[model samples]
Target: MAKLLLCSLAWFTFPSFADNKPLNSPVDYLSVLLSLVVVIAMVFMLGYLMRRFNVTQHGGGQMKVVGSMALGTRERILVIQVGEEQHMLGVTAQNINHLARLETPLEVPQASGDNFKNKLSQLMQGHKGKTDE
Candidate 1:
């Protein structure tokens, strides 16, 4: 980050070949539009790369939180599974700490496809049964 800042400062300090004239030609406008497109594409490509590398960890996959228990209003104990190993973590408002590493992995149940849909249908059916009574 410092390097980038320094490089940018250096860039502004250096002389440029650009005339700094106002855009007057269709070719100049086209060039500006193309540059804008390229910058936008680069931004999207960077986002794709970040998601592909799991940098943001948006979805549950190999690493997932198995369970969590709240200790206080601001603190909790969490069990997270990474690959086959399960780890206990202590989380607070300030920071997170690793509590322990489990020798035996905890079994987590897998949800069926359309889990929310199934749950909602079951609730609707239960409501109908009560009203029919």
Candidate 2:
């Protein structure tokens, strides 16, 4: 077991020793930093060019998220408007379910300050209070 441990230790330490060649010339920290900066700049440039050319996006028709409500810690209910039709979906970490298709679609909630939370709570409450007709 000691022999195995020694062998493993030697194997790990071997690379450090191999790479420890005496510096033939002074290490230019500035040049190394400049090269790193150039590489990062090149990556950003390429990303910008790709985005400018729209290379990373697949063309799917836009679907609007009308509204959403959090049911629990990893679960949500979403109302999505695709084209003219509206869909209510139950979303969880596990999977999504089709909840209902509204006959009379609910109005899109107006975005407000802290009142948005109040509106959301009220909306959820209203959903619970009202029965399906």
Candidate 3:
């Protein structure tokens, strides 16, 4: 009985590596690489489809955010243009309220060639001259 038990234990205890085959062949590696490439291509294709369909875009047709101002930490004022009319909205973290509607729509400013740093330096110089006088 002891001999039978020892023989059975030894038979099950050790894994046989006599076959000694490598886990992944070159073809296996190539298949894995091809699968990864296919997955990445699918992700990019999905992104392209989403953008082409404008799935995640906002304010496309009449309504548009013309300007916004930060009031506090989590509060803002937004000027939105819808067709010919403009509306000012007060927005907070928890609530949105209509402030006013402008009779004439505000013109959106165009970006000029003047850099912000140059304008800031000019403003600082003007303030210094005023303080000296």
> Could you give candidate 3's per-residue lDDT for residues 72-124 as a string of tens digits?
99999999888889999999999999999998889964323335667888999
Candidates' TM-scores?
Answer: 0.42, 0.37, 0.40
RMSD to the true structure for each prediction, in A, is 12.5, 19.5, 19.9
lDDT of each: 0.76, 0.71, 0.73
Candidate 1, residues 1-133, lDDT tens digits: the string is 7469545543443223155566777776776666557657877998999887657654357888888899999999999989889999999999999989999888874543357779889999999999999
Clash-forming residue pairs, model 2? none
Measured with C-alpha atoms, the lDDT of residue 24 in candidate 2 is 47
Which regions of candidate 3 fall more than 4 Å away from where they truly are?
Answer: 1-56, 109-133
Model 2 stretches astray by more than 4 angstroms: 1-61, 109-133
lDDT of 2 by residue, 1-133 (tens): 6469545644454443346644244343444455557657877998999888657654345666778999899999999877778899999999999999878877864434446799889998889878653
Worst 10 residues of 2 by lDDT: 22-31
